[model samples]
Target: MHGRCISCRFFANDPALIEATFPGLNVLSSAYGSVRSDAGICSRHEFFLSSWQRCRDFESGDNEGKDALLPVEKKLIGYSIGFGAVLLGILVWISYTFFPTGH
Candidate 1:
């Protein structure tokens, strides 16, 4: 038995994380974005594997015991929040226009 692949720096389980790490990959080939769920690429070995899969060459990605979000992921979350705020504003405007609170 070996350590989990997710703990390896070479393994990237999230498709968005993978795409962000390897920019323009999707443009080069859409197939790269179609990996199965919980599956990630082993950049060192050049193969895709599930997150739960084990490897003998397991090494910490220097982020032991830390659940830090990647910079790109942080930006993505910010963008999502901003979009949600804008959407909420639009919905409130529509509601106020269509339905009045005080008759």
Candidate 2:
């Protein structure tokens, strides 16, 4: 058993990972920010838990795996933002052309 959920294999608190796993969590709510400080999902238990919570079935994950996945997640986020920006620009242009305000 792990002393805390943060160190457990099932706990996923990394900001990039969280954002990648649940699209729009960062925009809709503070998943990694202080508003949910160190809280993450416990996949084994199927619960949203704080870092300090203890788990009886805790298993140490290969921390290196977590680190390795970070770069990929970050890239995904970057691409998503870039795509969103392009889409938004297109929508704005369409709106302005179709329903231009008197100026």
Give per-model TM-scores: 0.48, 0.49
Give the per-residue lDDT of model 1 (tens digit) for 52-86: 87778888775345678889999999999999999
Measured with C-alpha atoms, the lDDT of residue 83 in candidate 2 is: 100
**Range of the 10 consecutive residues with the lowest summed lDDT in candidate 1:** 29-38
Per-residue alpha-carbon lDDT of model 2 for 3-90, expressed as tens digits? 5777778888877776777777778785657887877888997787788888679787644234455787989999999999999999
Clashing pairs in 1: none
Residue 12 displacement (Å), model 1: 2.4
